[model samples]
Target: MILALSFIESPIAVIVILGSILVFALYYFNKKQVILRKLSKTRRKAVASLKTNEFVKVHGKALHVVAPLVAPLSKRKCVFYTIKLEKKVSSGKSSYWKTIVDEEKMQDFFLEQNGSYVIVRPVPSPKNYKSYLVKDEKVSSGVFNDPTPEFKELLKTYNIDSEGFFGFNKTLRYEEGIIEVGEKITVAGIAKWKTLNEPIPEYAYSKIVELISDEKEKLIITDHPKALKDSRHSI
Candidate 1:
């Protein structure tokens, strides 16, 4: 208790903590600015205006091009997904959070607006751009020791280390950001039209395009583009 009080009362300690926070904020915003500049060059168009064999930028709710995959932790049907793993560490009298594992996975899906839909195919590559709001949902959290069978399987699939240097003493939390059934999303890429093998109703166009992007153009997905304050997705 004496040590804690002394640290809090010390002006040097307070300044150091505040300075660290400011540095982190500046770094984050600077990176965001670079991303905004790239997105600004993308062309925006309504989904209905989307034509076969053309590159276009559009925003709308996400839908399953096929049966949606069930998120392992949340058990929610989604078209796109991302997961994060964190570890807790302590040193001396101070404790803090450390992220040891960060991974993301996604699948082909459709972006729809005003009853019009376009197929986004082959998942995005490392070069294709994507981002999300900070408001991701937490699926589960607990100590890493004696992990559940499902958790173990997930760790194995992703090759994550549940055991630290000494033992499984770390706390594990699973959180995900998903493109759900009806949530809004934005995408920018080339739409390559292909004819369908079978007839389907509601789709006036018999051809569906496989979306792709070049170095300059990118594939972006987000629930609320307005919240990001980026004009690229808004347009």
Candidate 2:
């Protein structure tokens, strides 16, 4: 007991512990802001001014190039969507939510601004990179309240049983986010121009550019108001 107390009382040990906690707190609170700052540093470019293989950023209304995807939980028409499912677990005197599923889907969309448009090709995320998605909608269900029919169907599609072995509903939460049609969005990536085999509506150029991600630069897309504000300020 005396030795343990001495260890705890040691100035070096106290300083090390406090420093570690401070580092963790800084990282936990500022991680997203750091990403936002990096995004803001990329200068916004006009669709007509984009150069081949140049890194660029753009903000405009999202328009679907093809059939829009239906958000699984909300059933909203969107070009991109992310869904998360978590289960509540208890141990000893403490309980925590454990993530059971995480999935995202996206398709090519057009960013229209000032009578011009550019295609945005969302690249498949590499193992080292994660796409930042905003999940604004959330729902929870537990023993007192059962999941809705639609929720049960979603769980079934994931092959996750909504009930325990004893036929009791398990505590679960669902979160979803989507980039709906006509929503303003910002995107940053490497730009490449390609020749169109056929012309599309609302664009007069014979060649159009598409924003894509590469090994050095990962594509970033967000609808967060703060991020959007920062982006505009950067411009």
Candidate 3:
């Protein structure tokens, strides 16, 4: 009997309390939603403006992102990350983030410790870098190529083997003495048939070196190309 009396007498108070809570929740959610939408818009615009080998700084890390986003995907508007990776981890191998971060709970990570990330655009050089492909023989070629005549000439001059085919392969950035002429290499990459594995008789280490050499020559020759490589290379 007493409970029935209390319910009837305070029905309006209960309604008012519920309404206030609902309003507060909606306002909080709406603010977050707006922030996320703006983030998505910015990312889309940034991606659209990206060049083949150029990367932009995002949440914040040094990621060599090959963009013009390969696959367009969407998540909550506040965050959308185009998938890029560190050297793919060996199954049992551990990386810096892998050790401290839970692979299974990536979202929770973004909510708290979003690091700054930068897309690493492939730099401009005169060489079409190839990966060493390894197939029946354990060697492969590079996934991407440079279509310059000078680049091709340098490869031929070095006697690099590019005959075998693969669908895709990756190469590292240009480095000094590490790239040697006449060095034999085994690589993995996609083939003409769209298969992503095969070894090329050649790799691009030497070619890239030669290309960098030629580029240096041109830079010494003038200020224009020099400025481009310098200013453009820097974020």
Candidate 4:
């Protein structure tokens, strides 16, 4: 009884717990500071011009792209999608979680302004401009149905334990990020000049359009309409 009680109240154990909490707090605070700084810079420099064949930064609503792909977890049609899969791990008297998958998939989409549009190729994320404005929705709140064949393949790829002697032992948590059609968005990048000879892909909504970025410049897409607050944090 004495050993158990001491273990429960050990000073080192207490310090470790407190230290972990402090570390997480610091990380959260730092992340917020960085995001705020980026937002401020974007707001200061963001433009709304829509002239073609010229490099510009703009923000507008997301337009249709490639018939809109269904988000894996949300089942909502969106141009851009990100999904995260986490697994529960158990240890003696303690448990923790590990991320098994964090992936983003997007089709070539357009950002539309007042009767004008730009083909956005959201490729080659910059080092400092990697934060995207997206909403995360919890699709699986720890409970899961029978794994689909695709999910089974993912399990094999990740080497995750799907079954034990009795039954499934692993708990899966699924969440997704979506940039839905008609949603307000912000974009920063170059507006490439489309050649008269070049033809827009048939999947695109329009043929007359300019590209967002080139090899020299990187593209950034965010849901912060005014670059003030990123809606992703609210979720």
Output the number of the TM-score-best candidate: 2
lDDT of 4 by residue, 1-235 (tens): 9998898779888899999999988876774355444554542222233345444455667887579977765567888887788877779999888888888877778777665566676653443134464456763333346655555555676676666556754577667778888887766665554543544444343244554555554456667444545433221
lDDT of 1: 0.65
**TM-score of every model versus the real structure:** 0.65, 0.82, 0.18, 0.62
Which regions in candidate 1 have their CA more than 4 angstroms from the true location?
Answer: 1-43, 51-56, 92-96, 122-127, 139-170, 191-194, 197-201, 225-235
Best by lDDT: 2
Clashes of each: 0, 0, 44, 0
Instruction: Give the clash total for candidate 3.
Output: 44
Instruction: Order the numbered candidates by lDDT, best leading.
Output: 2, 1, 4, 3
TM-score of 3: 0.18
1 or 3, greater by lDDT: 1
Expressed as tens digits, the lDDT of each residue in 111-186 for candidate 2 is 8888778888775545322345577778778898899988988899899998998988999999998899899888
Model 1 reaches what TM-score against the true structure? Answer: 0.65
Q: Is candidate 2 or candidate 4 better by TM-score?
A: 2
After superposing candidate 2 on the true structure, give the runs of residues whose Cα lies further than 4 Å from its correct spot: 1-31, 125-130, 230-235
Off by over 4 Å in 4: 1-36, 43-56, 124-129, 141-164, 195-217, 224-235
Give a tens-digit lDDT track for model 3, residues 34-105. Answer: 333323332221222233322121222111112212111121121112121212223566533222111110
